[model samples]
Target: MQNMLLFFLFILFMDGVSGADETESVMEGDSVTLHTNLTEIQNDDTILWMFGPEDSVVSQITRKAGLTSFFVTDKERFRGRLRVDQKTGSLTIRNTRFRHSGKYKLTVSREQTTIKIFNVTVFGVVGEMDEVKSVSVMEGDPVTLQTDAEIHSDDLIVWRFGDKGILLAKIDVETKEISLNDDDERFRDRLQLNQTGSLIIKKTKTENAGFYELQIRGRESSQRFLLFVTGE
Candidate 1:
């Protein structure tokens, strides 16, 4: 009975020594935040973060006085692409991708024994080009195209037209694809991505039209685009 009582006290002590949020959110193009709430440490406690789905060391931040930054052991593809909120201990990843989603573990340690657990989640935007549902383009004049992908961005995006099977742009987080075939040739360089994978075609004409396909690429996934051209 005496030994059992001592063991129970030890369990209680272990439990109270370290406590961290086991429910971390992981998303593509976004950093997942894991938090620790450790207490009762005589000296200092170390907080270590680990990731899987690729089985790599994500980062480690030692919780001593207040809070510190975690050294990303496997944040190669995620360099300059992730951020952690110091105040809230929240992690945010920029340009979230399908390959960037998975589970992570946080370990807290003092002297004798340490505690660790995992925070799992799936994160990333699909840039739904498949939901294009419909498309419309005009001749001689630039045709405006749209897609089902809601998070659209211009400038830093790729817009592949037709079945040419070529990457239109190098870096497109979320945006619609614009066809190279312009309505008036002059408007060829004046198009851009809209909120819904829609491309803004300028100077519409009768000779500048046809059915085009749209495809969206991400760090881990790709979406297809379908377009249609109409005569006015």
Candidate 2:
């Protein structure tokens, strides 16, 4: 799955109608900017910056009726992390994480479409983080782990389970699609991911007690949930 996504973006980077590509490397938790090289943005120009395999919009600057607007995606990964240079339409990612390492495409639209592609790689390995929460639930009861935050219109949320980090469920904001346990039957129909990216385990059993991880694309960090199903 990961390779296929990389290939898809590779094609876009290689064979676009018009583009200037650049490579960037920054340490984790640092800031990096992708420049558009435009001296000034015209009132009729629309600048868009997208990231990741899904090409989700991370930031944008647009003008309509002489009204200029700057918009950044409110995704958890990008929360308080992305900034746009109003004058030049450059995009900056602050406090970068490894997940931020991906292809970024900038599209400037007016009479002609100008494209710029950036392949960003954030260095440094992330060690295993300490578990932040312990959840206890009774067998045969439903347990919900709440993320308690609203994501961007097109945020990608991935949920994994157990010590092996098994694929449990995913919420694709771009397509508004949800899939659960494609390769694991232990979850089967028992897993439910809510709109807010929370996980609901129905009829959870004692065996469900384990480690679970929530990965929000664009997130600088993830919250680990340690489930302890009781009354087995």
What Cα-based lDDT does every candidate model obtain? Answer: 0.47, 0.76
Lowest lDDT sum, 10 consecutive residues, model 2, at 125-134
Best by TM-score: 2
Candidate 1 residue 173 C-alpha distance from true site, Å: 37
TM-scores of all models? 0.35, 0.49
Per-residue alpha-carbon lDDT of candidate 1 for residues 129-165, written as tens digits (9 for 90 to 100): 2333333344445656554444545434445543244
Model 2 stretches astray by more than 4 angstroms = 1-16, 125-232
lDDT of 2 at 6: 100
